[model samples]
Target chain A: MISALRTLLLCALAIAMLYAMRESMPGYGDITAPIAVRGAVGERVETQDFAFGAASVHLARAVKVESFGRVKDYSTSGVWLIIEGAAVAKTETMTLMSAEWQAGNGVRYALSQRFSTVSGYLPTERLEPGLPRPVLLAFELPETAVDKGTLLVARSLVMPLAEELSIALGDRKPTEIKPSVTISRSAGGAPWTLAAR
Target chain B: MSEKRTFWTCLVALIVVLPLAFVVRAWESLRESQWLAIHKVDIVAEDGAPQAFAGGQWKLLDMRRLPRSDDARIILAEFEASPTDPAILSQGACRVRLVDGKGRRFEPVALAEPAVRKMYPEVADRPRCGALAFTDAKGGAAVRMAESFIVPAEARDLSLRIEFPGASEETLVFRWTRS
Candidate 1:
């Protein structure tokens, strides 16, 4: 009986160890930071180098654009953007989103579709909804374009699944966020403050 | 002897196989690049007048008389195509876009703040856009603060969609802000 009990305990210990290790795999992807983007709309720059570089030029001085709706509930970004005398080739902003991040580069990136309802928010009902949400990522350019004139329409970015799990598991971080961009120059030469939440 | 030997072998296998299994699972999660949802928009202008309206908020603060050599109190955004023209002191407006180093494109999704734009379809396309300056005979010059805009912090990595008037599409192509 003593020997049989010891064997059972050993088996249980190994199984528990395996379970813990499996659970730890996702956290190995503990993503912490939010990724942001800035964009603009203009003509393809004229260039001879063959590859798209800054010198390749486009020409436009004014533009206007509008977007609205929620990206997620906890977040809200919707506005109508009007650019005056803005160079088409100049940097611009459109939208920004963030979720709880993983620690390493363990993220799986796939071209998944999003669906929005009349409210413009991602529905809590289904993952693959019937209606297609206009995922406008195909318009994103290179990082080099993140300069001035960049206008983005941010709505709601959901808490990453990992972060949500952490919260559910009682791990929460402070909400006071330090921004990546400085307030040196305003978008439309307009002086404004980024009221952080 | 048989039972003792079997127990010892099982213990060894448990330690070795467990670590090896973890190593394999860990390797499966690595990715070459991070894919982010974003878009690219570029703009350019050619009037030497500062752009007052853009996709975000903008204010015209007259700081020309503030002090000398400080960021020009006047602001010009070279979001794209940094001018390399030697004789072209100012080519008017410039371009801007949002992109990640890795190859992926975003779209004009939403607007975080308010913005505006101006154009003179009837004017001769040159001289300058945004703000312009002429070199005084003595070399010191006066500055003109024409247009400017304020970009919001949340506008990054998002697709920019602008509304323009009279264009064939009325939707000013994302990169159509040109010089």
Candidate 2:
């Protein structure tokens, strides 16, 4: 009877300790720290690249292609905004980084599909340190989205599922998240400039 | 009497611990199962020239910015096209289909003819509409398929379906965000 009682008491203590440490543990909830950094166009901002090395983005401009051949414009109610820029890598080799544009209206537009077929346009390019890779990420959005939108360029096209799982399982170290870049139209509206971080 | 009492206690402990150990082993096995072997799927704009069947012939799709109502969005998707066999040049054709949030099914424009011409323009009238294979530096083969489909401006959610030869059909969901 005494031994049984002791075992029960020990189990209760273990359960209590686990409950107390739940919040302190990494995978307990979604209350983790923000991983992205914020910066403006033209100004090169360093981002969290994990083991791929240091990365920087320079937002160039937002342009709308009026027409291509006899097909006319594809977007009926919206226009395609081709975000032109370059990303430079330092140290390690990098894979294609997915880019997304979030308008001030809260609508998020991914890279455009129509314009990717155009020659000399590269949306996915491996970035190695030294050489700057030209970025031509396009987004299909309403004309209202052009003037103000935040551009997010990250290594994963989708949520980092593997990393999230590893972090939850406590199997791998958590990777730092770089800040997203904010893009705004210039005074004359010819070019989009990155907002100050 | 004391010895009998101790034996009963020891047997009870063994019964509990043995089941716990089996449960842990089963959990580990499930975690390592092949059900988790889903390949990476990516949706991006078709780079270079997009070839599609137009006017009873294969032609290069114009890189035009068309309205969603007028023309469908042309997107390129990448997947693990590496075949288990190195001798297999083609991994067969893939059927690309999409279903919108509102239950609207959108079939990708016909790509078989264009696919053949793009890969083997020199070979005339061949109907080998399989995925175009390219060997990487590591001698592993990868395939690329260019497909076009229409998505309404108000589409809240989109699910892309890809059916490769000899493999189960897979559906990839695109969760759209308004803000």
Candidate 3:
């Protein structure tokens, strides 16, 4: 009887250990989380899918876009942050579909959808292998979150386990916040250009 | 003796059978998802010959590289498919791409940029691989397709690949002589 009881206890112990192991396994989100590639502003960040280099960052109160002889002006209560970068696909032709501004306090702001009609937007343009093209990303964020923010770029925002490039904007704040900025989209000249308004 | 046999059988099932069953279930799930399935290219046309794939004969007609001012070049690929079975046309749109020797896959440029349109106006009229299959071709006629890609000037040894998702598990790879 003692032997049988001991056997029962051992069986229970094994079942408990198995249950604990199963419970400790990682969740779906944890298992399929994005692989992050980190870099700093002004430095070229290369991922398995693409290469990106952020050249400049502009902070403005309002934005004016000139495209196809039509000018559209946009104003936001929050500050307008414009990111100018160059992106090239590493192997295939693909679109960079996700851009977000991650504030220092961990708040994330997606790229503005208001500029969807504007040409040269990074997310809408197709990227080709070996051909680097200029890309622009605009984000509207609270003034308090402008300093010490990071820019995140990825081929997709919803794809699990995809590569994500994070470019840190650094701790310094901008010296000048333009009252208005104009983005001219001309076919004969560069894809688009930014100027103070 | 009967109790000993029962204990051993139960122990064996707990140690091995349960985990094996879970693994088999996971494998089936992955295969059913198709996204995680291994892409095995079954048909390869290496000698510039037409290949029978997806109930059709596929041939790479022409391929050329056009030099641009920058470090990038435009790769134009023209292909054709002569269907042996008309059912292949209704099998849904096909996915096509260019794969280099180094395992780099290039998707076709969707939008016609001004530079590419100015250089190759004829390409603008030709349908892509997906649309070509559904074009107004009657009586098993050959459907011509074209696609353009902006690849790095140094990209070499490129080949075309076409895949029909629900119709066939095999992928068709066509190699072309560079002109």
Among all candidates shown, the one with the greatest TM-score: 3
User: What local lDDT does model 2 show for residue A104?
Assistant: 72
lDDT of 2 by residue, A1-197 (tens): 99999999999999999998975676623433235555555456555442211123322223333323332234335554444556654433455446667777777677766665443244545453333545555566675665556666665655533121001101121132112333343443223343322
Q: What docking grade does candidate 3 earn?
A: medium
lDDT of 1 by residue, A1-197 (tens): 99999999999999999999988765523553223332223322211111111111121111111224212221112111111111111122222231122212333221112212221222221111111122212111222222222222222244232111110111122222222211112233322112222
> What's the CA error at residue B174 for candidate 1, in Å?
16
Error of 2 at A195 (Å): 23
The DockQ scores of all candidates, in the order shown, are 0.02, 0.02, 0.61
Of candidates 3 and 2, the better by DockQ: 3
Q: Which stretches of candidate 1 lie over 4 Å from their true place?
A: A8-197, B1-29, B33-119, B122-179
Measured with C-alpha atoms, the lDDT of residue A11 in candidate 2 is: 100
RMSD of each candidate?
21.9, 17.7, 4.7
Score candidate 2 by TM-score against the native. 0.32
lDDT of 1 by residue, B1-179 (tens): 69999999999999999999986776545332244323334342222222323222122222111111222111122221122231333322322222322212222212211221222221112122222322321232222222222322222222222332221122222222222
Question: Residue by residue across B1-179, what tens digits does model 3's lDDT show?
Answer: 69999999999889898888888879877686769867676688874688887767888887878876567777888888888876865675788888877778888877654665787778656788774445577777888888887777777788888888766688888876555
Root-mean-square deviation of Cα positions for candidate 1 versus the true structure, in angstroms: 21.9
TM-score of each: 0.22, 0.32, 0.82
